[model samples]
Target: MEGSCKMKRRLLMFTLVICSFFIAGVVSADEDILLQQLIEETPTGGILELEDKTYTGNIAISKPITIIGKEGTSIEGGGTGNVIEIRSDGVTLDTLAISGSGMSRSSQEEHSGVRVMANDAILTNLTITNSFHGIFLNKSKNTRMSNITVVGHGANQLGTQGNGIHIMRSSENYIDNSYLEKTRDGIYVEYSHNNFIDNNTMTDTRYGLHYMYSNYNSFKENNFIKNVGGAAIMHSDHIHLEDNKFSFNQGSRSFGLLIQTSRDIHVLNNEFHLNQRGLYLEQSTSNRIEGNDFFQNEIGIELWTSSTSHVFIKNHFNKNKVHALTVGGESNNDWFENGVGNYWNMPLLDLNQDGIGDDPLEYSSSLSELVEENELAYLFLASPAITIYEKANDLLTQHKVMAFDKYPIMSERKPINVASVGVGIILAGVGVYVYRRRALR
Candidate 1:
């Protein structure tokens, strides 16, 4: 009886294992059938709508087709190549979650969530994560990438990780309304030109917008926060960076904007706040920096000796620990362009009330001359002792002027505080009620 019972138990265990394998094979068959339907069935230039289900493998769209996924539709990669690769022109991928790209940077093709080698590709409402590159436009032109959220593989080292949006040798692309974080660089433009990047939020990256040898690019209304460097416009020219917020990019060698070895750049109407350096210019010339507001920065502007022929006008420098720092030479740059100078938050001598100061506003101090030579001076920027020492030295010695505004602005052209006005109105109403009560009594 004991031998018979042991034999029955072995047969039962064998049957359970066979049942589990059969179920797994059925599921695998279903996944393979769906993948075959996607690859071998879709016609060229057709609109294929995926259901709200998960599909797997590396899809290569080699024809002009449009793939629109339903809500909650996801395409997981096979962990070998790019999740999706568009090879033909006029392809579109919308509303899909693409992830699990291969980690092989040594491959000829970059491993990415989506790789577009075709022109006029449109990618919208994509959630790309856990990929080497979120979206890589490789020599693709006239592409429109909008409303996408790209998160990188944050666990990888900086040298091995890729950028959120990497535009390489591409032109005339429109990238808008994207959120990029934890990437090596938020949006990297390398040898790309005539690109319009607007309404994007980039944070927790090396640089928000890393421009390298790119020209005729415009970045407008973007928010670059909590990054190592906000935007590094290096070895490039003809860039228009306007209406962006560069804030809280605090660290050593960090700045809201770094225009290095570039030319013909126009930086206008941007807000640079709470940065280690609001703007850092090095070896750049023939740039127009105008109508910008720099507030609460460690140093508002750090103009290197090699940076020349820059015109700074209508900029407001407010509450910075150091207004401007010139290293190694006199400031040959123009502080006032076309009769309007920057406002340094100082008392201006507006004798004729022409809204300009009569005397030139000088940024100078004997102690500043000494402290500017030391890199450790940044640590004591908020120290009262440093401020007192600078003022005392200025009063006792003939201070050397670092930079001067010939026509310092006198009128305040700041934004109106609606919250402050509301508080004042409430206070006045309470006071009037108290007075009426006293009179009645």
Candidate 2:
């Protein structure tokens, strides 16, 4: 019996020793340390904690680590330096406020707040302000950025150069829910392909979103407001723009949306207001434009030379000062909604009272075309020469005068409010009962 008890005691001691070793291993494995030491001691897939403090020096991350910043943490680069440089793949930066990065403009790509040259990296919920080239991604594929806000104050204290978010030679990336303001260009995608930019807000920038040689990219649900040159696309193909709002982009040469030297693009369900030109299509062909709203613009839609075979359907052109449709070149093959045209907001007398105008709406005429080219020609709109020009066009080319449904529905189709209707019916029944009772009394 004593020998059995001794054996049991030995087994318990061995188990306790093994457990102590396991506990020691776990405690060592889950140790949290400083940023530099954590980077050094951490394995490939470890977490690096950046505490809520101002980090001044530049830090180069060479390994695949997740740099998690504490909430309300600010990482301020003094000047002419990058706060976080990601050189390895699988890097993620979240909830960091990076600011004060601007340097001398030696090269076109000189200063940046965060320079990421790694693949499969993500930057989210980061605010970078007063910096040149905030969040520059070069040759990085499959990089995703969301909820990033970049503000370039263009303060006199620092040299002003570069863009807010510049993606060069990067492909298969996504940028969404971002806000950019007061930068050279809010989001510039150059030489990239197959990217997606959606749900972003860009204002007070030179150009809200500029895409050059970037093909097959989709932009949707973005708001470009008060930009100098809003949303220019050049030398790209198969681009799709949908449900974007371009408003208050007022400049002499600026446009709400510009498509140049592109082909096979589709623009649909967009709204443009108070811009110099609502939609400008130049040096492009075989594009589809449908269900767009152009209101209160100087020139609603302009198709300059080299634009051809574009389709326009179900578009609303209302309250435009000059021309609803300004067509140049010999481009035909454009389609309207069921042979019905856009709303011109002009007086077309219903002489026959058949719910259609007796005379067709003149979308393109000599006077309207001249007013589109020269903004000063709008002064002569009330002159007798304008009427003479319209009359001549109506007599010669009656095809220019297109007719749309006079009282077209302007509201979107929404679901019925059943609860409200039920309540209204109940209230009406109660009122009728009270009225009958009062009458009987």
Candidate 3:
């Protein structure tokens, strides 16, 4: 009986050893096929259709070639360096899953899933994960990055992780249909110009979209949600921000949009809601803000003393904690343009049949500044004493006017457009019918 048991134990140990060797062999075989080798062997302008396999190595494409891969094609770095590096223009990489890049604090270290030093390149349908930076472009122009998804490891420590898409000194690039989460800055642009960032969702980052010294860019239909800071545009100009949604960016110093030291920015048709400060402008000038909705924010617009020539037209401010406030003295910015002004939730009496209110809207209050200066004075809010005091100060003191909308529009309770309502109902009915038909089929 003892000899039989010993023989059985020996057989089990031998079988386990053979299985380990087999698994190791399979793994080695996969690692042996380096993507760099294949790229180097292929001629310039060649098209390489990668097989459905996991290539474990760093790759560098120095020539102009196109590398395409299907589903399940992965390029996993060994946690040592970038997964792919493109040095020549006209290089295209599509439909590849990349991960496991080296982490570094230095920007010169080049620790990214994909680093593009080339111009006029196209990167589409690529998914990057666990990388220090998903895509880092340095001085690369006319690059198009579309339908890219970047999932980070959620590292909040500074310099440990990088932006989902970092554009540095690049121009005329387009980033569209991308989703970025848990990165430092979802899309960071520095010294870049003439870029179009549209149809992207950036959430849970330090800043959803951060721009520093970037100009002539248009951001349309992008969603910035639940970020520490929603969108920070600093020292830039000629920016067109249209149809973007900035919401739920709540923090001590969080803002829906922070425009600092920038000029000639057009913020049109954007939604800024549920933020600590809807729009915090510091030394920003000559910007045209029109057709925006500022709702449920702590401060609708916090204008610094240096902000000037800002034209606010046809905006809707509803239920904001404070309609508008200034840091120091009152701002000298224009609130009305082209015979149109914002709709402030205030008491207005338009005796005439015209849509414009007869009286100008006082969008700021000296009483609010008093409450800020003296905290105990907040108790006087809604008290007749405060109102009397403000009136007395306005008459006797030379207090600077905060903001005046001479041509303020009527309240949102105005009659709805019948044409718009009928069109909306018809569109809703058609959408429901199509959805039901698709479900049935």
Please, what is the whole-model Cα lDDT of each candidate in the order they appear?
0.85, 0.76, 0.84
Per-residue lDDT, model 2, residue 198, is 95
lDDT-wise, the better of 1 and 2 is 1
Q: Measured by TM-score, how close is model 2 to the native structure?
A: 0.76
TM per candidate: 0.83, 0.76, 0.79
Q: List candidate 3 segments past 4 Å from native.
A: 1-32, 366-401, 412-441
Maximum-lDDT candidate: 1
Candidates 2 and 3 compared: the better one by lDDT is 3
TM-score-superior candidate, 1 or 2: 1
Candidate 1 global TM-score? 0.83
* Best-first order by lDDT: 1, 3, 2
Stretches of candidate 1 above 4 Å error?
A: 1-32, 365-389, 395-399, 414-441
Put down candidate 1 lDDT per residue, 1-441, tens digits, no spaces: 999999999999999999975543221222435653564455666667777788886888887877888789899997879898889999988999999898778998778999999999999999998888999999989999999999875524667778999999999999999999989999999999999999999998999999999999999999999898999999999999899999999876678999999999999999999998899999999999998999998788888879999999889989887778787667689998666688889986776656778898988754445555777776666578777877787788766676788878875673234466779999999999999999999
- For model 2, how does the per-residue alpha-carbon lDDT over 88-155 read when each residue is reduced to its tens digit? 99988888898877566875556788999889998999999867788888999999999999988742
Q: Which residue pairs does candidate 3 place in steric collision?
A: none
Q: What TM-score would you give candidate 3 relative to the actual structure?
A: 0.79
Off by over 4 Å in 2: 1-38, 154-159, 325-340, 346-361, 365-441
